[model samples]
Structures are given as C-alpha cells and as structure tokens.
Target: MAPATQPLLRAALLLLLLLLATSHQATGAVVATELRCQCLKTVSRIDFQDIQSLKVTPPGPHCTKTEVIATLKNGQEVCLDPEAPLVRRIIQKILNNAKSS
Candidate 1:
C-alpha cells in the first residue's frame, strides 16, 4: 500500500476499534442496570440479623412508601420494605437494643 494511504487506513482502523469498544461498554452498562433493577424488584426478604445499622427515609409527596436502608455487618447495604412484618420486627429489635444500651 502507498505510504499516504497507510496512515489513513491505520486511522480508520483505530476509529473503528474505538467505536466498537465504546459500544460494548454501553451495552454492558445497560445489561448491568437491568439486572440490578430485576434484583430490586424481586427482593422480598433479607436476613435482619446481619444488619448492623438501619436508616429510614420518609416517604415523599409523590410516593407513600418509606424506604428502610439496612447496612449489613459486611458493609453491604440493602433497601427493605418497611411494611413487611419481618422488617418491622427487625427495626423494633434495633430500637430495643439501643434503649437497653
């Protein structure tokens, strides 16, 4: 190939590779988001015993559901449904523990 044409070809190849990489990363991000959404939707219960801390966020005007954010001993956070019976019990336990201390 001609020297002038070689530079242009190399540039075109590099651009193609960059586009492919960007597209792949975007697709991966979409898939990960979808999976996380599915997991959140399907989360009905959690082990309250492992929870180290809990934070309750009051419901907003648009929504009437309060969010209970539980931080586990391992530092992982999970959002719990406040209306759940088990979650209420867990919250009570935490409150009792605090009061006793």
Candidate 2:
C-alpha cells in the first residue's frame, strides 16, 4: 500500500468502528420497570454451598448468598438458588445491570 493510502485506510477503519458503536447505542429499546425482571428461579437445584462461587465479574467478585439476597419492600426474601438456569439468569442480570448503567 502507498504511504498516503495507509492513513486513509486507518481513518476509514476508525470511522467504521465509531458508526457501529453509535448504531448499537441506538438499538436497545427502553423497557418499563414492570417489564424488567429482578428475580430468577433455579432450574437444576442447588444447595447453600454452591452460592459462594456466584461472584465472577467486576465491581468485585460474584455475589455470595448473603450479599445477593435482598428483602423486598414487601418483606419477601429474594435469593438465588444454584440450579441449571438460575446461574445463567443471575449472570445475565448482572450483565444487564452493567449495560443499563
């Protein structure tokens, strides 16, 4: 490639990346609070011990049972049971929260 062409190529790549990011930012539809989910149910069934490893991502490690569990305003205990789908849902919740903020 010629020397002049190199800068043009770099500039084009950067512009493409910027456009892709802008498009993505515009694509997520705003969802109502009622339509959003906060609790996830267990699928495979897990005991108390498995709850310890739940922390895996940033802002710190995964949430322990004590940390993740919250008492709702209505006095209901919201907790995660480590079954099959439960782990996936918990991870997704964390990721979703990260994206929204």
Candidate 3:
C-alpha cells in the first residue's frame, strides 16, 4: 500500500469502528425503553390503601433498582421505588399492622 493511502485507510477504519460503537449503544437504549414500555402496560394507577401485599425485591443483576412490588386485590402488581418517602411510609404501615396482628 502507498504510504499516503495507508493513513487514509486507517482513519476510515477508525471512523467506522466509532460509528458501530455508537449505533450499538443507541440500540441498547431503544431496547431498554421498549422493555420499560411493556412493563408499564401491566401497571395501573393504584392507591396506597388498595395495596394488598407490598413486597420488597432487592436489586439483582438485570434490575439494578430496589423495587417494592405492590399487589392489589384485583391482582394487579405495581412497581414502586423503595426509596420513595410515600412508599416507605406505606411499607412501614403494613409492617406495623402485621406485627400487631
């Protein structure tokens, strides 16, 4: 290969590699967004008092968020963040009731 041609080829290869990396990242973001959308379809607006069971799920490999799964009498489960103040209060209330019972 000619000396000047080699530099141009190297630059083109680097640009292609960078574009591939960026497209892969964008694809991952789209997948994540789609997953979240699918999960949301199972969730509805739930009142705190209607929660039949509030279970805490610790963060795992796939799900990094510590979630509180609230099951209602209608068999719908809504995911909430454990760190949220209102969720914490509801969890505490449930635990206290359990203890008294």
List pairs with backbone clashes in candidate 1.
none
Best by TM-score: 1
Q: Which stretches of model 1 miss by more than 4 angstroms? A: 1-42, 61-63
Instruction: Write model 2 residue lDDT over 1-101, tens digit each, in one string.
Output: 89999999999999897555433110121111222232233223333333423433222233222223322244333344334476557667757878999
Rate residue 62 of model 2 by lDDT. Answer: 30
lDDT of 3 by residue, 21-84 (tens): 4331211221112222212222223467677787675657646656566766666556665666
Off by over 4 Å in 3: 1-46
How big is the RMSD of model 3? 11.1
**Residue pairs with clashing backbones, model 3:** none
My TM-score estimates for the predictions, one after another, are 0.51, 0.25, 0.49
Report the poorest 10 consecutive residues by lDDT, candidate 1: 26-35
Evaluate residue 51 in candidate 2 and report its C-alpha lDDT on the 0 to 100 scale: 41
Model 2 lowest lDDT segment of ten: 24-33
